[model samples]
Target: MKALDYTILTLVIIGAINWGLIGFLQFDLVRVLFGDMSILSRIVYALIGISGLYAISYFGRIGKAME
Candidate 1:
């Protein structure tokens, strides 16, 4: 995969893990690291959202690669 795809996937994975922690343990990695609603945490959230959208495009790429 290309660099952009890799970056997005990494961000998405991180976000997913954070969400899992939050849901299962009542903890948030981003908030703990950056303070609630801090600039850094906000940026991470934005990147996570964008990464999720970018990941959707990879669905087609994977389909093609599998053929």
Candidate 2:
């Protein structure tokens, strides 16, 4: 994978893990790490969300890759 693809995947995985923590342990890792709704935390949240949206493009390539 290219660097951009890898980065996006990494962010998505991190986001998933963060969500898991929130669901299972009632923890907010990003908030704990970067303060509640602080600018840095907000930026991290935005990047994770954008990465998730970009990940949708992967579905389009699945068929092409299988060919």
Q: What TM-score would each prediction reach against the true structure?
A: 0.92, 0.96
lDDT of all predictions: 0.94, 0.98
| Residue pair clashes in candidate 2 | none
Question: After superposition on all CA atoms, how large is the RMSD of candidate 2?
Answer: 1.0
Per-residue lDDT of candidate 2, residues 1-67 (tens digit)? 6899999999999999999999999999999999999999999999999999999999988878998
Q: How many steric overlaps does candidate 1 have? A: 0
Candidate 1: minimum summed lDDT over ten consecutive residues — where?
A: 1-10
Evaluated at residue 54, the lDDT of candidate 1 is: 86
